[model samples]
Target chain A: MPSTTATTRRALLRTGAAGALAATVPASPRAQGPARGEPLRVGVMTDLSGPFAGAGSQPLFWGAEVAIELFNERGGVDGRPVQAVTADSQSKADVAINEAERLLGQEGLEVVTGIYSSAHAVPLSGRFEQARKIMWITSAISTAVLKDRNLRYVFRPTVHSDQYGEASVSFIHEHAQSKLGTPPERVRLAAIYEDGPYGTGVAAAIEANAKARNMPLVLKEGYSASAPDLSTLVTKLRRERPDVILHTGYNPDITLFLRQAKAGGLRFKALIGHGAGYAQIDRLTEAFGNDVNYVYNVDPVGTQMLDWSKLGPGVGDLAKVFVERYQAKHRVRDLPAHASMGFNNTWIFLEHVLKPAVRKTGGMSAEALREAALAVDIPVGGTIQGYGVKFAAPGTPMSGQNERAFPVVMQFENARGRVVWPTAIASAPPVLPLPPSSPYAARS
Target chain B: MDPFLLEALVNGVLLGGVFALPVLGLNLVFGVVDVIWLCYAELVMVGMYAVWFLYTQAGWPLPLAFAACLPFVAALGVLLHVLVVRPLLRAPPINQVLATGGVLFVLQGVATLVFSTDFRSLGVEMPPMEVGEVFVSGTKLAAFLAALAGAAALWAFLKFTYVGTAIRAIARDREVMPLMGVDPRRIYLITSAVGGTLAGFAACLLVVQLDVHPFVGLSFGPITFMICVMGGLGNMLGGFLAAFLMGLIVSVGGFWWNTEMSYVVAFVFFIAVMFLRPQGLFAR
Candidate 1:
């Protein structure tokens, strides 16, 4: 009787263990379906309540949401609905890492994207790599994320920091020589940047590119990002008297610099900015009024500036639809440049890579998605932003860099920013020497 | 002197004048209360936002907005003293510091929640005044003059008024003042209000020049505190002199090297002064 009771007890324990194992196992994609098919989960980690909440992350989130909505409306990724699971990083690096881990480990998402500050992006990208998940960095432009670190699963779809440097120098050299009658050799350049990865990377790139092109880079200086006063810097710039000043800074610094420069009467032949603070047209205009006029900003092509007709067929329609829907949803007249880039990158991944990956592997896995992404080969004039999507392979010069990604030089004329470089898509000619009203304009 | 260096020096003096306005109040409070108000800068930030709302958003005259900010901020200061500081009077210095730090965080968080971290500027455009080859910003010059006038008024009040004398007496000996029939609590409340009033005036001067944001106080706060410490805690005149000295060091240093080096030079000077004269440049 005792032997029989022990055997029954062992049998009951075995049965309970089997049941637990079955319960712990995730349901197959088919079983988890809502009538049609199970949705593909994509995690979006963004700064919703921190420093960059308004300027960087909020717009990015809205942009991605709009893109996902448009994609689902058009039958998302081979009839399977695309679901976005979002978590706020609170503009802190540790918090960003936690959110990324939660989305990937707990929520079981295979793909993740979105980070505003480079400070947050660097660590979060590493976490994504460790998890072996595909991280499509949409907005953060720090070069350290890809170049300084050995990241395999990480990919950036937007223009990088160094690209801004190269573009600013190249545009000034070409445009100034052509429009302002300044000799290429006579174009003395000064670079003032906020002391951070974003500013330093751009400054270094500007120096290298200018050296390569044999252009004279006269002075380069770095200042604290949150310095209360930049009057001394402006005074120094005035004394040095460079023909063109290339600056890299964020909102407050840029506002302070421009205002102080104006107050000090520090004028240059042309003033150029690398995205960041310059892209916020509304804020810039509000702060400085006509002072922001004619300042050339090198940034990714904004949706408003993109002439879709010049791009391939249907690209124009896509651009129109995006702008219309974004306007309708956000109740804003213009879609932010970061938002457009986010939308475009996400759309490209879903269309060119995600759907194809699902068809090839018959399921959504990190490896399959990455393989599909690597196989993508979209040519120029194919994307809604008038640029193509073709990411360079890992362990290369342009490693994980979008080879076709380039910035357009937009000149702020009458408080309106219009594309003015690379002539083909430019709405207006480059205003070399700026307007007479500009602080950097050539004095009589 | 080279014209550029001369200009930098002049600019530094003007900037120093602006810096003194905020530091004076902080110095006064620290001198009397024997407790550091870590949230002093955030008080100025609140004043700035108030000015922006009243002057820019509500379409009130700039002078009226400035007037409104003073009382509003002074009230806020009294409220903070009553709620946060009063209970911690008997606590250790570290406890008081930690509590004030909590107040700082709370104020910053509230500002962020209400204002949404977006930068707002008054953009009070006043044409600049040119002196020789140097261009003096009209806003900066006005702010400087206002700071000087405000400093003179404060000096007069502290020197001549009975209440001011009582407050000064309390700073000398908080425990002994109450024995002499002066209510320390009432005097402390008045001191906080006066400090907040000074912050409001400083805010008006700053809002014209700098962008108003939740964290704008941080930009000027640490440096103002340094000035207070170097000025001999409660020594208003010493704080005033230190403000200009530090400002000159920053401007001249920045001119000679860079902004970072300028800060380094200022800090080094501060450290040296602290080592040599613990009571500060002016103890009396």
Candidate 2:
């Protein structure tokens, strides 16, 4: 149930075609910086026609499109407008590898960006590193993409999965005292996740962070994301009665777990979720409505939720424009966080890396972009998502990762997520224990 | 008994009940037509999309949506048999399997093209009821009962009605039935439609319990076929019993160890059952 009424997807697609048309309309020849020959070509690769299309890839490209469009409006990179050539990743790993070859090799695009799955990013980054082309990763957050891989060509300004675990556990540690009436170390915790790279990675973090702090780790298990039954898992949880549960799963499994847990009478004081499925709040809201309220999810802060005043002077206004363009065209009431990830990360490349590379070298090249990426230094609260750009330098662990990037804990209040953790960026206090109104709320 | 163990057993019975209808539908087709509609689960998937589309998109009431789902999927079953299965009836069994498999792909591809992979639900839920020390999921309980009702109705149809007798007779001896004044072609078509109605029925039950997506059939489809083969391929009663047995093993094993391990244990049991009784556990 995206607010894009079925009719609107058709309407919006036509609008999208027109928008794509408008991007290439050639800025007024007499504008400042003067028009020049041959626009800067960047390949926008994403999952446009498969499983990852709707919730993950489509908005990612839209967000990137917004950033590129705005940059072109402001007279482009020294009057060479960006002309994006898009490719479909199609939710297939093999297709992703092939598309990378096609986009970077046959198509001969130097700077390629926009990835939705870490599965795609992992292989794509490796190929780009070998081929020596600039890949400004807009939004795919697997630690494996950049972890210990000293590739200078690939760069991500988005939060990765490893940071996901730290954010949720850190929130619980800080708030367990006042809200749960329990010491952080004494809290009963359980971790459940889909037995996939993303889920396993996050679950590991949750376990490590909890154990390091001596939190009572009651149970940790992984189930296939497509399991037809979670009743047994629910029964086990009911038996243990964990005070809080850390779960990482895609939307269907999350929906299945919630439905079954309610039916099995499983109760927990609080439930924390990592991004992937949780990024689409509308889906969760459509499934549970008010029952989802007060549930905490960890992801990079949504653009609309951040206190934009602290995001430097012009960044706030740029965010307003991003939201305005994004919401009106996509017809989403509550902006999906992926769109912001698309916009901010792409903005970083356009404003920081691409422009600087072309300016410094008088034209774009992989080595110049790599140098510009390494030299990037934006302090915290610098970008639209309130995280800055600073790629983890080569030879260090997590090369090409924006070390300043971090996820925050947000709770659903009437199905709209409000930041509630990492106190400084938080707009509201963490509603720690589940309120009695929730069907799964523990009976005190 | 440990309450947890009791709950696990109850959950198994409930799980089996939902599993039974799909098994019953696929078994019905395998038994009567002698051709396994390998795309059987995809029919259920289509029916699920129909129910979801009617209820959520078309603004129909839940019951009306479900009512529409049966006939809709039944017709799809008829269409499938007419377009795909009918021509392959005279072909090799492998060719038939391949054709049906193609239908599975076509159905999945079309669903993906139309719906994408976003999981849709009926947004329906039922509370858990306490029976003494154990908790029973009311939604599952109701689905289980509905499944039993579906199984019973199918049994009654095959056992009592004139067409049912012809179907059973045809299933028993396909070559001999044609000489006995019963048109095998008509019966196959009728059975195909009936099998479809059963899929539609199962889809109704599953839509409430599980989310509907294009690849959802992958989750339960293999397991259903396993139950069918383990229950003697086309034996309705054997499939019925085997479904519960598989469900119990999955549930209790999961209770003992973990979800993935439980499935491993179920597959192992299926294999063991095959080795011990090659024709199937209850084939005789």
Fraction of native contacts under 8 Å reproduced by each candidate? 0.47, 0.56
Checking candidate 2 for backbone clashes, the offending pairs are none
lDDT of 2 by residue, B74-139 (tens): 999889889988898889999999788877866866787688766687788887898776889999
TM-score per model for chain B alone? Answer: 0.97, 0.98
Per-residue lDDT of A347 in model 1: 85
Cα error, candidate 2, residue B153 (Å):
0.7
Off by over 4 Å in 2: A1-41, A48-58, A72-76, A79-95, A101-112, A123-125, A130-136, A358-368, B91-98, B271-281
Relative to the true structure, candidate 2 reaches a TM of 0.90
Candidate 1 chain A, run of 10 with poorest lDDT: A27-36
TM-score of each: 0.89, 0.90
Highest-scoring model, TM-score: 2
